[model samples]
Target: MDFSTLCVHGCSKRYDTTGSVSVPIFQSATFVHPGVGLSTGFDYSRAQNPTREYLEQTVANLEGGADAIAFSSGMAAITTLMEIFSPGDHIIATDDLYGGSHRLFSHISKKNGLTFDFVDTTDVQNIKKCIRNETRAVFIETPTNPMMHVTDIAAVSKLCRENSLLLVVDNTFLTPYFQRPLQLGADIVVHSGTKYLGGHNDTLAGFIVVSDAALAERLRFLSKTTGACLSPFDSWLLIRGIKTLAVRLERQQQTAFRIAEWLSKQDKIRKVHYPGLPSHPGYEISKKQTSGFGAMLSFETDSKETAHRILERVSIIQYAESLGGVESLITYPMLQTHADIPQQEREARGIGECLLRLSVGLEAADDLIEDLRQAIYGGKANV
Candidate 1:
């Protein structure tokens, strides 16, 4: 079936008794067995829930993975994935990432005894140079947050294979509708389902999808042990959100491309970071791997003053954190998403104080463009 078809029908179960299209939420904490010493597949909700199981199965199908596990939040999924390695294991990761991820690796994971090397993954050589004997994995975020740095997944995966390392890709920006990292040789694929997969900013969830059976088993065990499984209600919400992934992303990306083009032409804007733009460094490479350029983008103003003005003035496009929803959101990386990284490191990564990331929504392109214009120039659209 086509991706659009899969969005609605893939891996979804029908109610045998009621023939309900929606996957019912099995809200019970524990299940009853019919006989002594007998049991159902789901003995406890912590281990499994019918609603969550359907969500897992649907996501697994979407990503072309052997299995998928849902979590309470994106960070929870990532934390659990990291637990597969012991204290001394090191990882090579993308330099520019979501602030929360930076916090996890730098502050929390380090205390747990895991070390990380952050590098510009757009160039495979950086990853190659960072690979120490103790390096167990390469964690990457293609079209990386704020910067829109696109890494060559297949190239990195090849390097990982040669080095006997796992390649984990965060598919949050593009989701399965636009990009399937597993198909490009990623050992593990992760997502902050709170974003595009949830479509509305109404719930929080995460996912770990993988093709390797052994790896899947390990993740399953860790999920159950950690007890961070997504709630039945959230799972149902994600299922509903995913049903429109294809259409929502199509509209969102269309608007994003227009916005990026407009920003590039603005005098107050110094640069635009968007994979969809031909001038972007990652444009060609992104074209080769992903089906679409995605709705997330970032741009740098001529100065901090101009960025501040836009942030304070935008009326329709909200000034906010978090992305991939029905409403457009603007975020300041220096203060919001990448602030956890040290100032020196953040500057080195090119996420300066002037940078602003935008998550385009299903809003009309012209209206959003007008909103940005008035916010930046404080005038009505003349053209």
Candidate 2:
């Protein structure tokens, strides 16, 4: 079946008991066993739930992975992956990562005795140089947050394979609709389903997809042990959201391309970071790795004051941290998302005070541009 058809009708089936078209929310925390020696595949909700299982299977199918585990949040999924390694194990990751993930690596995991080295993974040679005998995994986020830097997944995966290290790719920005890292040889693919997979801004969910059955078993066990399983209700919502992912992303990507082009022309904007833009540094690499350029874009205003004023003036676009929703969201990463990082570190990564990240929605291209124009011009005049 085509991806479009699968979105509407994928894992949803009516049962004889309820006769409901939507996948019923199995709200029970524990399922009854047939007998003392028999089991029904699901013994407890923490370990598994029918609704979450549906979502897991659907996401696994979408990403072309053998199995998937849904988690309470994106960070939870990432934490579970980190759990696979011990205190002394080393991890090589991209320098410009999601702020929350950076916090986890720099603070939480560091406290736990895990060592991490952040490098520019876009250059495979740099990544190769950073790898050590103790390095157990390579973590990468392509079209990296804020900067939109693209890394060659295939090159990194090949490096990890040769060294017997795990390769984990965060596919939150692109989702499975735009990019499948497993096909590019990544060992594990993670998503903040709260973003694109949820579509609406109402739910927070995460997922991990693995091609290796052995690794799947380990992750599933870790998820169960940590009690980070996604709620049945949220799982149902995620499943529903995923059905329209293809269409929603298609429209969102189109709007993003238009917005990127428009933002590039603005005199107040210093630079636009979007893969769809021809002048973007990662445009060529993105063209080879992703099916589409995605809907997230970031630009720097003339100064910090101008950036804040523009953010305050925008009426339609909300000033929020999260992305990949139907409604447009604007965020100051250096303040909202990456605030925990020291100023020096953020500046080193090019996440400046004037940087504004925008997650394009399904809104009309002209309307969005007009809203941005008014906000920028009005804010500048007021200043």
Candidate 3:
């Protein structure tokens, strides 16, 4: 079946015989036992819910993975994933990461006895230099958060295979619609389903999809044990939201390319970091790995004052945190996403006051550009 069709119909296994088009939410906390020696396959909501199960099947199907587990949030899924490694284990990860992920690694994961090395994963040689005897896994967010640095998944996966290490890829920015890391040989694929998968700012959900059923079982054990599984209602929302992922992302990226091109020509903009543009360093690799350039892009203003003016004055795009929703948002990386890192380190990583990340939405290209024009020129929105 086509991916778009699969997104709508999923595995076509029905729990209830009601023949309902929309999967019904099994909102009960626990299920009644069919018999003393038999089970209905679901004993409690914490272990599994029929609605969440349906959604998980769809997500696994989308990624071409053997199985998947849904979680309350992306961080919860990641934290649970870290449990697979024992104390004294070391991991290597992308330096340009989400603030929350960095906080988890630096403060929590480090304190828990696991050591990590942060490096630029775009060059496989950089990753090779950081490997040590204790290294257990490599975690990366391709087209990395805020900076938009793309990594060659196939290259990294081959390296992991040679070392017998697990390779995990955060497929949030591109989603399954644009890229499938599992198909590229990643052992695991993580997603903030609250973003493009949900396609709305209305719910929070996460997923961990694995090509190996054994790995899926292991993570699922940790998931239910931690009790952060996605709620039945949020599961339904993600299901509905994913049904339109194909169309939503197509429109979003179309406008994104237009805006990225326009920003590159603007005098106030210093540099635009969008892979869709030929001038981007990652453009060729992105074309090789992803079907689309994705809707997320970041740019640097000529000065911090211009960046502040655009954030304060933009009317069409909301000046807020978070991305990959129907509504466009512009956020300051220095203050919003990468603030957990020290100022000097953050600046060295290319996240400075002049940098602004934009999540392009379903807005018309010309309107978004004009709104940017007014904001950049110091005119009022009403003017």
lDDT of 3 by residue, 107-169 (tens): 999999999999999999999998889999999999999899999999999999998889999
User: For model 1, how does the per-residue alpha-carbon lDDT over 1-383 read when each residue is reduced to its tens digit?
Assistant: 89899889858565347878777887789999878989777789999988898899999999999999999999999999988999999999998888899899989899999999998899999999999889999999998987999999999999999999999999999999999999999999999999999999999999999999999999999999989999999999999999999999999999999999999999999999999999888999999999999999999999998999999988888998899999999999889888778999999989888999999999899999999999899986433
Each model's lDDT: 0.92, 0.90, 0.93
Q: Residues 288-380, candidate 2, lDDT per residue (tens digit)?
A: 888999999999999888898889888888899899999999999998989988999999998988999999988788778888988988743
RMSD over all Cα atoms, model 3 = 1.0
Assess candidate 1 and give its lDDT: 0.92
TM-scores for every candidate against the unseen true structure:
0.98, 0.97, 0.98
lDDT of 2: 0.90
Selected candidate, larger TM-score, 2 vs 3:
3
Q: Which one is best on TM-score?
A: 3
Worst 10-residue stretch by lDDT in candidate 2? 10-19
Give the lDDT ranking, best first: 3, 1, 2
